[model samples]
Target: SRLQIVCWTVLVISAYLVILFIRFLNAATITDPFNITIDWHLWALLGLSASSAVGAPVIASAKAAKEPAPLQQITADGPRIDTSRYPAPVTKAAAAFSRTEAEVAATGSGVLYGKAAPADARFTDIFQGDELNNAMYVDVHKTQMFLFTVIAIVGYGALILNMFLTTTNPASLGLPAVSDGLVAILAVSQATFLAGTGVTNTPT
Candidate 1:
């Protein structure tokens, strides 16, 4: 969700810069170079993205605070337990190996604390589940949000480019108007993404 907001922001800023450049090139003197008209739909799209970006983390954090501590098991060698509630391992073998080490380190000390640091992050993490049990699975909400964001960026970019190419007045060229439908689609996608973050399949 944050990435999507950054993409839209970059697109809008780039377009705005290009418009300003065109205005400078066409005129010798301008009173207000930064006075570019922005359509309300564009603002609405930005607001939606910003709201989702902010709300997702708040929702996830709240959910995490309410989750129960992870369950563990004791063994002859050491403590053996699932680490899914902690940071995820990069691979199944790594997870197994970590568990073995934990078992070996167990000295019948009933106290256990600390969490594993997350492995090197990957772009694929965006589409994967947040909870450890389903971390390897694809998240439909994230996938849909990603798809819609890409579509909006591409569609809006093309519209702006087409407008620039066909406009008779470069000095008057403002940001291209976004359609209500595209904004609506993005709004829905962001809402679902936030909703998905608030939900977890972890057994209570």
Candidate 2:
């Protein structure tokens, strides 16, 4: 319990730290930007700060009391698991949603996830029924993490593009404040999701 509390505290603090760093960077490094109308530094600071408020859940969820895991069920003979709804050879990365007896008897699990994997054989792969079925309030954690990852990649890409364009000439794409804001939102969102489950942003 104490360990969980510490982990959660760190998660919330991490969000705040990211917001603070962004603000500081805007203040120090971006005071002026080629005489633009709006001081984008300020915009970036405000937007990111608002998004960082998503850390509120971390402390709240952490301090909440824990619930016990479900125990085994008892039968006339001793203990028995009513896995009638579960399928045989359940050798999938994850389990399927509860299926009706009639449907299970007819369709089977193989019929359920009838789809192709990604060619790269990476996490990008999704079965046909993935989007159709709702597994959790959030889907795979990898996808959520990937959201921020894409944001970061785009952020660096913008900087590189700016450098390349400036080298060639002064005409190129502008910096992406929206991308930064998107990453801020994603960071805070992941923190909130982790807080709810008493999990930290630290990778599994």
Assess each prediction's global lDDT (C-alpha) against the native.
Answer: 0.71, 0.37
Evaluate model 2: give its lDDT: 0.37
Residue-by-residue lDDT tens digits, candidate 1, 30-70: 56677788999999999999998899877766645543323
TM for every model, in the order presented, reads 0.75, 0.31
Best by TM-score: 1
Residue pairs clashing in model 1 are none
lDDT of 2 by residue, 29-81 (tens): 55533322223553553444343344433443442222211223445888575
